[model samples]
Target: MMAVALVLSAVPLGAETLILGTTQVPRHFNGAIQSGIATMMPTAQIFASPLRYEDDWTPRPYLAQSWEVAEDQLSVTLHLTPDATFHDGMPITSADVAFSIRTIRDNHPFASMLAPVTSVSTPDPLTAIIHLAHPHPALLLAMSPALMPILPEHIYGGPDLADNPANLKPVGSGPFRFVEYRQGDHYRLERNPDFFLPDAPRLDGLIVKIFSDPMTMLLSLESGEIDMILLVSGVHDIQRLQAIPGMQVSDAGHEAIGPLNWIAFNMGKPPFDDVRVRQAIGFGIDKRYILDQMMAGLARDALGPIAPGSPFADAGIEPYTYDPVRAADLLDAAGYPVGADGLRFTARMDFIPGVPEQGRNVAEYMKSQLAPLGIALELRSAPDFPTWAQRIATHDFDITQDNVFNWGDPVIGVHRTYLSSNIREGVIWSNTQRYSDAEVDDLLARAATEPDPEERAALYARFQHIVVEEAPILFINELPLYTAARAEVTGLPQSIWGAISPYLTLDREP
Candidate 1:
């Protein structure tokens, strides 16, 4: 606890208020029912999980003072900190821990992350024992705030937890307390007086301003109307903002482990069903050009679903280099020759919005590049994120541009993209491509429970090889996540996951 107190000392008391900007408004405050960085970023500050991950991706205790795993790996027991209390003044107890674990296991979009846990039992107010059906190597990592936000049992333990009114006005046991939320405007939070950590949350309050237009958000940051911009601006804007005198821009150390953008083909649809067609499209697109011209060299060419920096990434795999001639050959050999109209097939390419014009630029580039191979790609744009996600969930497009934010572990992040069981209707952002392989599924399943680190890494390496060969999605590039703030802001956390939780330690200089 002395180390924790030392970290809190970085933010002095005089640093009173902080204002941040975002393009996406939170749809709900409940972490269990919602799935997106927009919602998670805000809710993370309001709730306290038993465990969290450090920048190195190792588990660290938060609400739970300490924990132990049985030698058989069948159960884990957590000891809670006696002094911790929720924002509502209720003492945090083992009942809240057990309730949150069970609720999230049933409702979260990545519920598969907790598939190993069979039940939770509370022997006392400060003790919770979790029973597992099998060994799960990454269980602690999965308990990070992003995956398992511990909710108050009294507030969210009802039968209709998802529809609870507390979702709009949340109360939790974190360093911040909810103050107010004005839809499409801003959400405000103040420091939690009863927060267990001493001299924490140096800022008196936090304000997250919502702006639909990214340019407006940038302007706000530049004008000092907003002190920071969290996750909205693009790389191009970030580069420009860095030149300003009082602004500070950095990737926050997430470039090595961020989301990789790709073109996901609907395997349930025709043309995409053919492995040759998928391979042809992969070879046709010039990812290097996209990285240079469209991305401003802020991204790296990705050959597989897992980024190169991850432990599970396959070093032997190579990206499908840009070869239009080979692309044409594959299309012609597949019996789709150049017709009198000089077109092999016509298909629509759907683009997800909120990418700050990069999505449209990439779509246009793909259209021009694919034309030489006798492919006609009609561009379509979804009005908003929800509509765009629905199109992906329903398999309503031929090809779509999408990305997955890897949750530090492949089991929680990469598995959903290719797992056969994840191809359910209305489940947005999973394996909507519907590409399934028995061997790959088995590897993913085994990797989840493999206790040995080397053994788990080997399993995922094989899984990566299989997915790359199948070409379910056209692996593109890993984009760097940038955060720009005033020079006065300091000690902000930086990582692929828990991007916003650093706000707890952030302090502003007057």
Candidate 2:
């Protein structure tokens, strides 16, 4: 009953086709933007080597044959494999490596990931030496996704590629080539015959199908129209997918699932501008109620910015508990008084419904908590994504439901959010609360420059402590990252780091 499309009539075997389903095409393909595409096209090798492996959340080599660090741990040198080549049969050189890092810094798209690099140089044709402004122990982990996904220097000259023809149709060194892209619908990729890996990328082609709604995507999976779904909608979505017959489910709980959901405050605004108010709000909401009523008790309450599974996560810091009396007292001390109508001064919280049910469910739970403290809680809902983005950028409301995309590294996700420079242009810039603390910024800066793992962890712990006490945000549930595929697919390894390789050894049942 399976529909197999044969692309090569000359090949002895039937062509393998895979239909991959997702809620949306990636927001950005730049590795710095996110890792969705890299997971799908693993055949593309990087110069620095993968910092985290598919099996473990630890670092591993991909393109770098071997690497050595100075005794002072200030400089790191990477030697490229002689046989490693791009999809176009171009031997990747040290020049290409230097260009890749330089491009990331010059271009704004990769600013999030590449801003930490102090300098990159090539001492030899096949060797790359990178120097950081200071010792960065986590530099290896930070480079894993962005710096490792090396781009050909010749493709886009050291400038913005927004208007470049390559942006629409990119040519990667990955095992797959971009065949066709139907905007807002689906994109097709064909295997690269010139791929470097041997006996890799078993599928002849891959089709990434985007659905407007989860129900339609689920129906496609039930009807065998698609082989798998990438992102999970919610806890119930996982339950529903598992119920489907003849399907395999892979769920790597906390680390892969990403950070717990939380509420972001517009710290630039009044009331929340006060640390006490922020702390009161953090203590006011009963996380247990939301867990039971909204998330179906699937998530654990996050104690701090770093989730529990992270290596840098600090467990000694006590988590804030719900106390209505304390919340009301804090509100009173902050100069907000309850009127005759019993409604204390409160601002409207803006939330966008990703799926119709999720918005209404979470908003109502938040409303219940505020009502008890004599706060006039109002909900402003946006039905779609564009509208939501606009509202958050303009700081149109008091608070919003948001989640940080943590790719196993704590610094990449948390540090930027707490930085002040990122709060410009109305967009949250990851700093949803627009929080600006000199001490917190100092800790983050020191952590980035400190190459010692112990020192970095200590600095980060101090930063987390400040945020926890200030409570600019309320920590929420860490959603599960899951993969549901057809039973025939094999050799696809399970990973907690969230860096999956679809091109690795997966094959269909004969």
Candidate 3:
């Protein structure tokens, strides 16, 4: 059950190279810092000992040969494969695995996922034990995805590791190793000489060319400058690129089955503190119009916290249709009257400047829908991500547009966005709405540790029900899946879990 790389008849494997294009370049290589690590280090593997991950997010054997969960399920022990070695010729060890977990928990900027871990212990040279303060039913799922990237802690520790050039030149124990990085131009990687697997990566090296715009990137793909187009930001661009003659389109569909878009209301403010105003805002958004016009009908209109494909997604939570009379009636009842300009006295929305063109389309649609209800929607763009984040934390805007990314677990969306702990230290990424509900929190606590599938599903469904009724955030449409590869590339099957298509498995066009 392994894939071998093959080449076009005339091209030799060692001489073959593949070029990849993406519309946007990631800001950093640190996996925790951003969502782009899997793109950058396609060959890298996480160091979760015996628990290896397959493409479908099921656990298999990788650097870790195998693992066992104690009968109580309170702990898990892993055995590392002796064959595995880092690119620097260091043998993979249990200490490295322990250190990797600690590094992410102690120093990684995005530690929200792993903050629950109490301790990691290396009882022997080849085995590591993870003791949990509480049994996590989602542990297997978390270990399979974002929370499990393995690092060589021996290299990444101390101030030197913190400031090391190796952050960019990552010597991963994957199928490929970083070769060269030309700022704003291209980053290149070659086959890892230390790779443990046999009969491996067919291509000689992989080149990731960064194009500033989608049109340029698509053109590069057609001209053979780039072999594949990784991700397109909007539906219009996806359609245009698919029309290109030789290129093949693969639709992976909605990357995450959780809420992708949410229209956030600042509950710390006056009107939003009232559930009626929040519900009015929800009813005012013409989601169907936005999905049809802006997203080319490629978007799924959402009704609750979970998307349609999510296991916990319940259809019973009804969405409010755009009825101007109903929207205006709710606004009037909330004591917001039409002013001299025939606009409800509403405040402006703050959005990050230079946001994808889709944000502008959404804002324009909101303006049209709210205008009929006599609501004035002022759209203002902040300078950058940090600036926009700062404004959001300070509750400097009445409304904002945000796409909450989560991997189907309700806790990822529920706790981070509406829970009380997220409001700490002027840093509010998830909980921008400042929403809190005692009953919702109680349901969340129950859902977190409840192992019974039926029970947890019931608990989360209740939480989602409360969230929809309270309406702190306006649920928006989720995008349809799409991935493109030149006709020659092979080995990719459609995945249900939808972790960004594994880059290591992609081969040269045959």
Write down the TM-score for model 2: 0.88
- Residue range with the least summed lDDT across 10 consecutive positions in model 1: 1-10
TM-score of each: 0.92, 0.88, 0.88
Candidate 2 local Cα displacement, residue 3, angstroms? 9.6
Q: Which runs in model 3 stand beyond 4 Å of their true positions?
A: 1-13, 23-28, 32-57, 197-199, 253-259, 339-341, 412-414, 493-501
Q: Which lDDT tens digits does candidate 2 get at residues 185-271?
A: 766777767655577667777776777778888777777777777656477877787887788877653363355567778888888
- The TM-score between candidate 3 and the true structure equals 0.88
lDDT of 3 by residue, 1-510 (tens): 001121122223355677667655545444433344343234232222234344344567666777887777677788877868877888888887777677666765544555666888888888888777776666655453344556677767666655666666666566666666666666677777667666665567776667766677767677766677654556876788678786777756333334366678888888778898888877887777777777887667777777776667778887877776777789899998888788777678865555454566687678777777887788887667788888887778798887665564665444677676565547656676778788987887777777787998898788888898898888887655566777887644244444342344656654
lDDT of 1 by residue, 39-146 (tens): 878767888888865566567878888999899989999999997998988899999999989888888877777878899999999999999999987788767666
Pairs with steric clashes in candidate 3: 46-150, 47-150, 49-64, 253-481, 344-374, 488-509
**Candidate 1 collision pairs:** none
Best prediction by TM-score: 1
Q: Which stretches in model 2 have alpha-carbon errors above 4 Å?
A: 1-14, 26-52, 108-112, 145-147, 158-160, 253-257, 355-359, 497-502
How does residue 250 of candidate 1 score in lDDT? 71
Models ranked on lDDT:
1, 3, 2
* Top candidate, metric lDDT: 1
